[model samples]
Target: MVDRPNKPSAIAPAASAPQPTVDIADDNSSITATLPSGENVTVLLHGATVTSWKSGPGAEKKENLWVSEKAVLDGSKPVRGGIPLVFPIFGAPPANHATSKLPQHGFARNLRWEYLGKSTSESTTSGDAGTGPTDNSVKLDFGLYSANLTDEQQDQWPYDFGLVYSVTLSRDTLQTMLNVRNEGQLGFDFQMLLHTYFRIGDIGSTAITGLSGVTYTDKVLNATEHAQAENAVRIAGETDRVYKRIPQSTTSIVEGDKPRFDVVRDNLPDTVVWNPFKEKAAAMADFAPDGDYVHMVCVEAGYVSDWVRLEPGDTWEGGQRLRSLL
Candidate 1:
């Protein structure tokens, strides 16, 4: 004798738009971005560093960036691979380090960044890059301010500054832009580099093109300057060379007859190509395992070998974009 409803329950509401998937979880230490164009990238808040980038379909889907299997994900130390930012100092301590107490590569890679929410191509006008595939792009901004630093951190580098690092994903193309602004009263000089670790199916057969006419300083052989003699730069053993005064050009990393990726830089004048090889690879604990260095290569964009002098209230900008080839 109970009355029963004949109509089914209301259907679920439909979403207004097909938003690209993104997740900020694990206590907000990392972000996973899944683009609509079959691309996925992961960003770590600690260094605002991009640890992984993968694209393509089916068997073509391969990781373009290399991160060590045992990389420290807890932010305790710099991750072994991916793109590590070397800012305010590229190598050893600079002669004019602000408080002269900063670490080897400065504090940019070790400290956490402030995520300034998502940015779209429609909202922004320009970046350090002059051209890009901006339509339907997913952009994220990470910031670091010296004022927010602890007293001890300030003691290491006293100059006030702000860094807005932006990573934009447009389909299969990835762009990273670094914008540094001086907030102090006087000018400061510094060196910087974007150490990019690229993944390879086999490193022994790979050769990089576009450094033939360029001049480089070999780091392994007494830091001597040498004119590149080969059309294709090949790695024999523990290759480490820093090309200086590089012209605006595109460099391609090839596996066999086909290219793996194209590295394009803007305002970055130096290029560093390094691989620890077998002997040195086994000697380091951070590199991990017995022979992991062969699967990765570092083709960095830099402004070192010469210092960059930034005036107060001025900004210094540079960046590099990587696009994987199918």
Candidate 2:
């Protein structure tokens, strides 16, 4: 579905900047704020359920997607943690735990997104521009577009693309842009993940600084016996890995005891740092069932196996930028 570049029929509203409504009880559980020019953000939803994900002033309550907002992508449970946007493919389901059909990180996190409103935009140089749209926050535009895929998502993804997810809260940064549009013509190839579940107050004195030389995929050494960690692999036991290529101008520091989460990315290469920690989080029953594991930490932004090919008219934009330093 990625053939978008022609939206200019009417999206005006950026003069003095007055569009900050964050009161939700119903009315589609609304939210669209902006703080302009320099940027500070806000975006909360309840209908399609995004539920307040702020940024800047030290990015608060951040849950980019993960865990069950409604729980859509099959593989039995899959959502659990936070920052889950694993499109097309991300993990699990070929491990015999495979239900022959669903249950794994698929289904774009259990389908139900449809806010589709709010504006103040800009994008050119072929694409990517902001401070042009406003709900306010220096610049704003919180969009969501999905075409309706259920039936267990056509018996497990047949083919029919067009998933545009835009969460632009501005200033100091909180950008998550993903536009995959290939309206079922015939050019499919997937693999994408944002999976970010970062909250960490202390993971044994956290220290994931910029991922030194990057080259990982050690699912715990591909399941025992082939260990390989050249650098920055510090999370203390039971840390399932999957890092490759990664270096879009790095930065993934996470100091302990509160206030320090700088996971930055841009046109990512691949980075995932999981933590099932105690008996795979008690044999997963919606994970963290009660363990809580120090707070949270998933640091992901992938494109697995070099999968990113959408050419049916084409439109594939990737993102990841969570800058909160305190």
Candidate 3:
């Protein structure tokens, strides 16, 4: 009692004063934020590379590299996929509609993405550390605002438009929303793709559901082909097709053995799936040799094979959702 006499009675104030918080890191080359649910996400501003995502216990350590770092798409071989945002065309020049001088896939994909901001909600489903449901997670928004090109870019494609690409990563899903604002006086025509690459257990074991009646430009077959399966179409070898005239709000299911991922496009009209199976993998240097084929697959949503014309003051929005199921 004597020792405790000097201590004031333990009583809490009406409300603990708001804790002093540090500002978010906004420097170029890196963007980081702590969500309301305590989850954290970071992106490398330089390459718009997703650096880290973490939640729960084992999070004393965070997971990094949402996209491949080693894979560089210069002229040799591209990353194959992973929401690359290809525009105008897909493959290299001399082979496809693309031209070598146009900066393959247009300049949007390669441009540096700016950090718009971060958002969180308790609405997302939560999971444990090592083995928990990362499904229904927080949505982090990162985007690039349209800017007048430097002397360099103007020499390539001369057009003025406010192009904004917003990429949101949730627990079970990853969504990319593109808003192309026509700010110029002239109406321009263009095509785009949300080249998404999903990690797969085995390329041969999986299939993509949806796109039953849709017609596709078979880049490999050199003709248009219809979907054979309504549920999921399995990937075999060296597949390259541009499914066109697809309606918005379609589901593309990627099924594996235990964990399956379904890519649902909210308003995407096209889907392109590619897997350089044998000879192509060997011919390309960016690809991880033949042995690494089992790791990923590209199912892209695009306007390619179909041209979209945007008039001045008009805006076009397109988005894709990546949902993973166990």
Pick the lDDT winner: 1
The clash number for model 1 is 0
After superposition on all C-alphas, the RMSD of every candidate to the true structure, in Å, is 7.1, 19.7, 6.5
Report the lDDT tens digits of candidate 3 across residue range 91-153.
543334223456666665566666566554333135555343333334445555436345666
For residues 1-326, could you state the per-residue lDDT of candidate 2 as single tens digits? Answer: 78778865887775654443333335543344544342333333321223335444433444333353343333343446545577676676454322235556567665545556555543233333543443343233333343476666666666667776776664445667677888777786777777776666556777676666666667776544222344445677678777677665565655643436566667778777887666776666666444565556677777774667787878788877776664
| lDDT measured at residue 295 in model 1 versus the true structure, 0 to 100 | 88
How close is every model to the real structure, measured as TM-score? 0.87, 0.31, 0.73
- Cα error of candidate 1 at position 262, Å: 0.6
Worst 10 residues of 2 by lDDT: 42-51
Tens-place lDDT per residue, model 1, 67-182, is 88778978899888999888878777755556257788778888888888776442223564434323356788889999767798887777889999988876667888899999
TM-score of 1: 0.87
Model 2 clash tally, residue pairs: 35
Model 2: residues >4 Å from true position, as ranges? Answer: 1-35, 38-84, 87-89, 95-115, 119-147, 150-153, 157-166, 175-217, 224-271, 274-298, 301-321, 324-326
Query: What C-alpha lDDT do the candidate models reach, one value each?
Result: 0.82, 0.57, 0.59
lDDT at 295, model 3: 65
Q: Please say which candidate is ahead in lDDT: 2 or 3.
A: 3
Better of 1 and 3 by TM-score: 1
